[model samples]
Structure formats: C-alpha cells, structure tokens
Target: MIKRSILAAGLATALFVAPAFADDRPPTPEERAQIEAVLAAEGFTSWDEIEWDDDGHWEVDDAVGPDGRQYDLKLDASFAIIARDPD
Candidate 1:
C-alpha cells in the first residue's frame, strides 16, 4: 500500500510537471533571425546552441548581440520577442 501510494504521488507530480516542461509555442521569423544573429556573434557558427524553452519559447546560450554583449535571449513560441538576459 505504501509503495502504491508513493507511485501514485510520483505519477501525479509528473503529470503536473510535464506540461510545465513542455514547449508548445512556435517562433516567428524576426525572432528566429534575432536568435541566429546572437548565435553567430557568439561564435556558435551553427544551430547547435539554439533551442526551444519549456514554455514553447526559443533560447540561445552564450549569445552575443550586435552590441558585443553576451546574454540569453528568450523568445515566445510565436517567435515574438520575449525576455532577455534570463540569467
């Protein structure tokens, strides 16, 4: 009984957390370009560092902007510009 209860609790926790970890939003063209630019400036030179966040948003790690500053830009799924400097 205790094992079953623990399993059920774990399942319940997973169910609640799964969606929170899911990325359902899509990126827009401008947002894509911005992300790419950041990646390029950061010496990524590839698509390896670009990825979607759990909220269906996009993100690029160690990205450098045109201003020569490094940051992590977060974009909404719609590709709309969202948050910047997440960390």
Candidate 2:
C-alpha cells in the first residue's frame, strides 16, 4: 500500500510539473495559413485584425463573409475554433 501511494504521488507530481517545462511555442506559419484557410472556407473574407483578449483568448475581427456580412471569430490557445457570430 505504501509503495502504491509513493508511486501515485510521483506520477501526480510529474503530471503537474511536466507541462511547465513544455514548449511555449506559438503556432507555425503553416498552421496559421491553415487556420486562415479554414476561416475563409467558412465564408469569412476580410481578416483585418487579430488580437488577444484579457482572458488569454484570441479574437479575430473584421472577418467578413462572402455575402458581405461581418463576423467575429474567437479561438483558444491551441487555435481551436471556439465560437462564431451571426448564427
């Protein structure tokens, strides 16, 4: 039982600490392009600007659609599409 507890503690520590030293790299150029392409394909046209919000989220503004309707695209750190407007 003691051995199991020790092993569990070590595993938990490793799980918590490992991600701290992990890469903090930003998205690659290819990834950016892919994300842009996906947005464009979804009818977003004018990708005027992108900014990070205070909550550590990203907001892509001025994303106009083919029909000329503007939209706001929000994404998380992993570039995962979080929400869309004009639903």
Candidate 3:
C-alpha cells in the first residue's frame, strides 16, 4: 500500500541521514593524545579544540603551529593529516 511504502521510505531516509546529524563531540582522552601526537609530529604547537566527527575524521578547530599561525585541520581515521586551512 502507498501508506506502507511511505512509512518505509521515511524509515529508510532516517537511517541514511542519522549519521550525518551525529553530534560533533570532544575526543576521548586517549583519542586526544593520539591526535596531539599527530599534531606534534606536524609541528603544531597547540590546539584549542579537537572533535571526533561521526564521519570517522578528526577536526582541529584552532591549531597553532611553530610559526605562530593558526590552522584548521582535518585528519583521517588513521590520524594522517588530510586537509589544513590557515587563518
């Protein structure tokens, strides 16, 4: 029935979109240390915020580098730096 189809479609949409709406959360202490180790290796002196995204990526909101410049960083699940945006 059309009603059943509509309900199924709604349920399917919710399942597909749930991850996209996942909360951005602070990294766990262990996760933070891992992320910090990566930052250190990349010459980032400090970071203001680090979030573990639902998409399996890490986001550094404000990372200060050795050169005293701030950068926004994106890292893959493996902790490899994938993108850097300087401000």
Q: Tens-digit lDDT track for model 3 on 1-87?
A: 999999999999999999776968888899888999999998999888899877778999889988999999999988899999997
**Steric overlap count per candidate:** 4, 0, 0
User: RMSD for each model, in Å, please?
Assistant: 6.5, 7.9, 3.8
- On TM-score, the leading prediction is 3
Candidate 2 lDDT for residue 20: 65
Estimate the TM-score for candidate 1. 0.44
What C-alpha lDDT does candidate 2 achieve relative to the native structure? 0.72
By TM-score, how accurate is candidate 2? 0.50
- TM-score (C-alpha, index-matched) for candidate 3: 0.71
Question: Between the candidate structures 1 and 3, which one is better when assessed by lDDT?
Answer: 3
Give stretches of model 3 more than 4 Å off: 1-21
lDDT of each: 0.62, 0.72, 0.90
The lDDT, on a scale of 0 to 1, for candidate 1 is 0.62
Kindly give the stretch of ten consecutive residues in candidate 3 with the minimal lDDT sum.
19-28
* TM-score sort, best first: 3, 2, 1
Kindly report which residue pairs in candidate 2 clash with one another. none
Better of 2 and 3 by TM-score: 3
